[model samples]
Target: MDFFLMVISGAFSFYWVFLFTTHTYLLLILSQLTYTDQIIPFELSTHPKHCLSVGTRSRQVRVPRVLAIEGPGEANARAERTWRGRVPSERQVNARSLPQRDSLHRYEFTHPQMGTVFRLVMYAESETQAQAAATQAFAAVDSLNASMSDYLPDSELSRLCNQSGNGQSVEVSEDLWQILKLSDRFSRQSGGAFDATVGPLTRLWRRARNLKEMPDSARIEEARQMVGFQNISFKKGQKIELKKTGMRLDLGGIAQGYAADRCLKILRQNGIRRALADAGGDIALGDAPPGETGWTIEIPASQSKEVTSSHLLTSLRLANCGITTSGATFRYLEAGGKRYSHIVDPRTGWGMTHRVLVTVQAPDATTADAWATAISVLGESGWKKLKRKHRRLKAWLTETPITAH
Candidate 1:
């Protein structure tokens, strides 16, 4: 499980909320503060280190230690009024309570979806509005989960998988279509590094996780045959076709990031600008709190050794974007004295055996999520090759284990 430690503006208690994603879990940090006109108290989550070890976990790609955002001069009315969130890096989020009130209350609400907890911390004037916005946002998540989850047998994604190799294209919901497009784009950009079609291998790997042994080499090869971005073709009008009979589309890596983004959108639509949506550990932030310039994200500084890793907390303050970290720290498999991350490399049907954390920041969580997975596979140098192409994104990496103090 991923550990999230929080220390807010005033007196705050450390709380650990567990969210299960894939075979991994996330420890969430939440704090309660008085909802007042004064600058809204920012709820902070302490990351184990300044760098995040990202892997196929987010099924993601790019940025460095610090990811920049749209500056005040670069932002417009809507953009200025909007804010961004962060991942497992030094990105910060500053916020205010609320201007005149009348929005989602300064409260946190959560629900389980996509194999993790979807959390929303927002502000509003009336409890009624807060409840209403939460209800709508959670409802959207539930609906989206039904559309994307591979675990659900009758989910839209499952239905499409069932149609694999039928030589027929299936029309998807708008939401699913959007995610598919992203999956395709990243898959191409990362050179098959971040593929949603890694479902076959993931299924086999899941068994490996439970059985405590690596899947048979032959089985891995068999599953790998069905895993490739080329196997799934996206047609116009939201039609998706799986050319392979046993292809499975695994969106585990990036779905939550997209969900986090949606959560922020819903919150904004409900008149809540100062908000943050933590989908599992993937973060989606909103406009600065009531008075602050941006949200502050503190990631502990890290020093990696051959066998262990240690960290000191480091903080960065910024606004308006998405962030996610993928690593094998909490979720991985140990077989034959080897540690395997839960993130399955779409290229090779094997979980990464290294100890690397990848934290990616981008304009949205979807990009951050997918790219984190890609970067985990690509390494820092690989990202640096294409870093100039994605100027708005930043990534950070740290390898080894976290030595507890």
Candidate 2:
């Protein structure tokens, strides 16, 4: 949502390179060019954090805390000179050479219900341009949140929820309508594995979680009766309606990804070539600069100190792609001495029990988000199904369970 660009000096022996300064304590080195006798040779970094940002509308709505830059030694020196306006001492040069900053132009905001932060980074042509872009990005995010959030009484989602049991057709904003249609398409493709018509089920579970007690089997079955994609109908140029009373719709599963996709479009339309947008766990990457393979992404590993071996993602890059992760790491309830995650299978009316996490890569955020949820529910079988149906979709699953001695 926010943009930034660094014009570092071409790498040369003893050459001075300048990196831009930001408010966040991170630097993003877009590229490093080695200038030997004025001949420029470039190398790409295999790090996702190094690549441009990507994601949907919600990402642009939030601000980030860190931004890092990468460059050769000469470029770093030049960056220091540009920001500090002086030749750097050895210590300053060494410290600045690595991606460290005291501040950045990016901004961050927290979501009340989602319990996570959203970030937007920008590289504008000038200070004025940067501010304008940031302002627009923030406004866009507010508009999106107002439209999609269920917590807001007037939000499109909230209005729909209120009319759930009335069998009344609701007119949704164009943006929200598109997301629902996409969810329908994905649900069919995944054999009802990705349904947005699980509002009743999700709400029932939320209440059960708050009470710290499992819902009665009959109650769950009653809620399940209202949870089916087939229950909601939509037509082009028309309002969407629930076929049966008590049927509801919730877009939590795919809304964040849709927001990411929308934000990416806005950034690209504004002539941003490289950026990253993250809405919760959904991330989208803009184009890698010329000669760059892709953005390098870090898949957090079992230990906080270590991530999956970098070698595992040696060639992984998200050039114009979307990445989303779904896991039961949080938001669960305990019953009968067993833990149940917040994510539920629409068809089964049960919370996901296996597979601790699932990360998916796809052409778009919506697909990535829905597939991540569906596959996590499907477990190994879903993985196989996805591999057979769509080769372009790549996935990873992690599981951890308690063992009794």
Candidate 3:
């Protein structure tokens, strides 16, 4: 499990504001005077891209691509990668370690996107700018989530899934199209370990988790028939189609990381040079935080209560890269003395049975998030082969060390 505690202003109000600098709608903060002026204020600039005309007036803003989605814990049942830090539990955020009245102010906000708490941390000279920047960054993630979330029945990805088994190519947004292409590329590269078409299997295991039992073999097989990344058809002209009916696309593994990357972009564009956008476990760091050299993180070997600090598998200082850790610690199904991870292997129509915790660091959050799960599915041997093939990809896997040969 990952823990992040961000200190932010307590004053806030709830309202949905849709603002845009590009074709995608950005989730803007709505308020007055102090909050509103700093965030999405109406102003006129020569840059048409940044200004939206309203009642013969234009508001100044930056032009950039955005995605949209509802707040967290408000939608259908989706695993949400379980990395996005939710409302920080008492143990997650340590208040004593934090600095007081620092030169660089830090701001945090919780978005209901991905069904988890997305904590955006930004360092700026003033509290107003930090709050504004964090708001925009989270809005960027909300936009991406709106487009990629399978939980939303009306989402772009869900609509695409509805067009499945039609044997006809349907046009998709550039963002959705790009994500599907990456999904296909990684799915092939990982040899079915990282599959976007594992929606059926994920749902099955989710049920098993609730029941604390294993799924029936027959139902598993039925879902398996609809689970295959190879069944997706990506043709020319940015069109895609599911090869079969009953096939669902779940971006649980990669979407959050991609959203994190986009959030980083939004932060940089807003002149925020140092920040950390932690989309659950998928963390994208933009430079170091203020005076710090790099962001510090710990990678543990297992979730076992007995595992101590000395048992740490890896500790990292990360900057300008994406870090993701995948394990069965938080969510799993246990039955017949066997514990199953929520990460379903699409090829086998089952969950990851091995007690493996895999962490990967890559140039981007998307790759790191997807590869972490893929490496976990591959286990030790697959990781060795993959490491040899992708030299830049860093991974650490700790498997069942209880039993000796």
Q: Per-residue alpha-carbon lDDT of model 1 for 112-197, expressed as tens digits?
A: 77777777767676777778888999998889899999999999999999999999999999999999888999999888879999
lDDT of 2 at 253: 84
The segments of candidate 3 whose C-alpha lies over 4 angstroms from its true place after superposition are: 1-103, 301-314, 399-405
Candidate that scores best on lDDT? 1
The clash numbers for all candidates, in the given order, read 54, 56, 11
Give residue 124's error in model 2 in angstroms. Answer: 3.6
Number of backbone clashes in candidate 3: 11
**Candidate 2, after superposition: displacement of residue 247 in Å?**
1.9
**Best candidate (score: TM-score):** 1
**Model 2, residue 337: what's the lDDT?**
79
* Predicted candidate 3 versus true structure: per-residue lDDT over 34-83, tens digit per residue: 23222222223333221111011223345321111122212111212112
Worst 10 residues of 2 by lDDT: 32-41
Query: What's the CA error at residue 59 for candidate 1, in Å?
Result: 29
Evaluated at residue 122, the lDDT of candidate 2 is 41
Whichever of 1 and 3 has more TM-score, that candidate is: 1
- Choose 1 or 3, whichever is better by lDDT: 1
